[model samples]
Target: MTKAIRSPALVVRAFNVEISRIQDQTSDPQTAAFRLQFWQDILKKIFVKEQVFQNIPANPIAQELFKVSSAYSLSKRHLEKLITSRRDLLQTKLFRNLEDIEKYADDSVSSIYYLLLSVANIANVHADHAASHLGKAQGLANILRSVHVANHHKTVFLPMDILMKNKVSQEMVLRGVNTDDMKNVAFEVASRANSHLEKARNISVPKLANQIFLPAIAVDSYLKKLQKNDFNVFDKQLQQTNALLPFSLYFKRVLNKY
Candidate 1:
């Protein structure tokens, strides 16, 4: 990575860690709210002032983020949206509809894409549009992949409407039952993710900005494997990581495709 992009990369990694801590550890709504507020205030200091890096939160993650946010002028709204979604996840499990799932994906996933683009100083409208859809695709794909793990944790990330439409129940999902209905529901969700991936592929971005979406390669590969298996979320095949993923991503990056 270029010097200009490295700090932002570090910052984003740190930011994701902070989000994971809140989402994976925090169980109390009030506590989650307070933790999110702390990060929000630190981000406010970075984006609202030019030279407040020295005065930003002392937490290592926040401190690194402040440097990148100050350097690249990352959008405060995007950063805050990232926080807000993690906070909401403390209480939100089953999405009411596909649209609700899509919105959650946009706020939680696309927000990261937008910030990375900012760090790369990409201001092109087309790239941002593509990133938005790509983020949604990746986010949904993630939920599909993690169904078993989510179920083990007693949380269902699948949209309730889709599950109902397919005659799958929360009980079936939580118990890892591989009913036809569950497979149908998984197919619908994967189809939505595939659609978004297709849309993202149709957009044109400059070579420099393409690296930001290299993750799409892995997302695409994983989705294809899931599709090939008839949308069986519990199949050990789906759980295993693709061995070819690294080479595939490298080739895609070399070709400058997201």
Candidate 2:
């Protein structure tokens, strides 16, 4: 019953897990592409009212997603964008500037928030705007936290503009070399993320949509940590979630404050 009640959340969680699995487990691009295509096809089926699945989807996640689709008028484009962004990440794409990074965040992060809003039947323009910025903030903060691991995996999320301006080299980032330039670049990106977060907070969220922004509390905490660390991307401690993160998120959710 609990699982049935939270099927939408489960679907989102399962999709994210599959993405992580592709990144961590799959080595061949062709194989990864096939896997992503499979999910894409399944999503298409889910969107169609009569065609739930050509074959019964054995994957629990897909089943849950199908259930949610039946229950709510979920946006197919937003859900598809989530998968597309993950597919894009499979092929290396260097972010050219802050705009590039923001676009990526919007595609990868904002799309999910929009889907969540749709699940809650939130249609207000202001809530949508707030969710978009909040998604950016959360996405950027997440990348900031994973910089060390991503660098080690030869993945770069920092914008080229920031790296160039700060004279931070790709090799330096890939090898986890901590430098003043890297710190500066992190500082700029973190600053931009915080600005988006502030913008999100300033907007009035509808009472029904308040819980959708619960992730904001976590994003806010991460921004504060980055500030405390002087925006050091290589700080090992930054990888750790705040000790009180669960409690903080719970409190914020219960209080209906993002």
Find the candidate with the highest lDDT and give its number.
1
Per-residue alpha-carbon lDDT of model 1 for 1-258, expressed as tens digits?
Answer: 456686677788678768757756755678878888888887777766446666776788887777677667778898888888877777675688878888988998888888888888889898899998999999899889878787657788899888889888888888899988899999999999999999998999867778888889988998889989988998888888788998988787777776
Those runs of model 2 whose alpha carbons end farther than 4 Å from true positions after fitting are 1-6, 52-54
Candidate 1 residues lying further than 4 Å off, grouped into runs, are 1-3
Local accuracy by lDDT, each model: 0.83, 0.79
- Alpha-carbon deviation at 24 in model 1, angstroms: 0.9
Candidate 2 structure lDDT:
0.79
TM-score of each: 0.94, 0.92
RMSD of each: 1.6, 2.3
The model with the greatest TM-score is 1
- The digit string of per-residue lDDT tens for model 2 on 176-241 reads 888888888888888899999999999997886777778788888888887888777787777875
